[model samples]
Target: MNATETFDWAAAGESLAESVTLIAGGARGTGRTAALSLLQLGARVAIVDLDPGRIATVAEDFAEYGTDRVFTAVADCTVREDVQAAAAATAEHFGKLTHCVYSAGAYRAQRPTLDIGADEWDLIVDSNLKGAFLTYQAVIPHLQRAGGGALVSISSLAGRTSSPFLGCHYTAAKAGILGLTRHLAKEFGPSNIRANAVCPGGVVGTRMNDLLSELHREQDLVELAKQTPLGRNVHEPDVVGAILFLLSDLSRFVTGATIDVNGGILTI
Candidate 1:
């Protein structure tokens, strides 16, 4: 088969009909979009987020997409007990848990290295790096008990390259996830558990996109796009497609990989 025909995407289409997925921080942004995507693919979903009302609202809005395929939980991925509770609830609600997407990361765009404070550094590190670590620590047992599963961490373009608009700590933490993904792949591959990451560039159509849209100048956006050979920014759907592939058996035997969903951006 050619590169385009490597995996059977049709398997993803219907196999997910009875599948159950647990998404961390799935109430909004890429996380929410991802949850909806998985549900659309026919997976029963339990979306975890920090906001009860927002989760409830989004859960209701997308419930029809899931039919009985959707559910919601209000839990902080950074908090261990909350993660434990959410995982337990997801398994109980769906009657099975097969995939885990650690999509809860924080980003606060600001002036480059010299302009940021110490506390801001800690905040970004704690959220991006520590949060990913916490989610893995809390969910490992669940995945293990399930006997085998797929674990995907959503990273960023900053991990692959430095950006003037994003702080160094954010980039560093995002980069750390790539290393972590490789380590987990080696450690858990024997158990049929695969670990991978999606590194996305400036993504449009998310809360972060709209927020950053307000902060970035047109020239800045264009300059950012220029780094990529594609000459355009990537959309959420583009990144999500790669993510969905990583989560599905379509990428079976693939592990410890960090996929770049950037239009063409790679640090020089």
Candidate 2:
């Protein structure tokens, strides 16, 4: 794989240019970062988020990338109709949809499974798992009809195994995403739709990473770096690069797979 800094967009445009991609929860964090990267790579993108103001501002900021290429819609991923509307508009805007990236949700307050509240559990699950499921169901038809597309579902390292440090809901939802990806990949492969999950561990600049950022500033970054065989904490761009590969033709033969962008934390 080539470094993103050296990846030539012009060359990619001529060959693997993508017309439309949906970025859920794209107002901030990894979702927004990934959307920006995709835009820079010449993919027409649609930003879907619950926050209308932020969505509008981001769409405007990305105008220079291609006014015709950037789109924004305020939608709650937990709502089916919202996802449907967003999907329909995306299909209409780009003439055809080729990629679907679902990166929506929040991980707040680590609570023990025994102590987790009903509302808290609902909040995380609805946003992470249900939201992804709703968005995928809505956008998949468009991809299937157009012959096929790529899907990159965000999962977390906590999901790979039990974590006393992470909240129960967060890890569970992330694990669920993997199961969803596998099922979708198997069911949709014949239609040419490829689905994969990216499980990230302690992303450096992401919101989740901020939880212990101060304490981990120096000693921890070094320790975390060592935890990963790569000798560096995971970064948004690191995960995004993995994401783009799954979206591009480079992984055409890949599907029903889960890629761990955890800097070699789980080498199994």
Residue pairs whose backbone atoms clash in candidate 1: 228-264
Give all TM-scores, in the order shown. Answer: 0.88, 0.89
lDDT of 1 by residue, 81-192 (tens): 8888888887777777877888786667665788778988888887777777787776777778777788889888888886555678889989999999999999988877
lDDT of 2 by residue, 1-268 (tens): 3445566555554333554789999888788888898888767888999988889888878878876788889999999999999999988988887788888986665567898889988999999999999999999999988888888898878778744345889888998999999999999999989999888877777464576653344455668787677777888998898888888877767897888888777865
lDDT, candidate 2, equals 0.83
Which portions of model 1 show Cα errors greater than 4 Å?
Answer: 1-13, 208-218
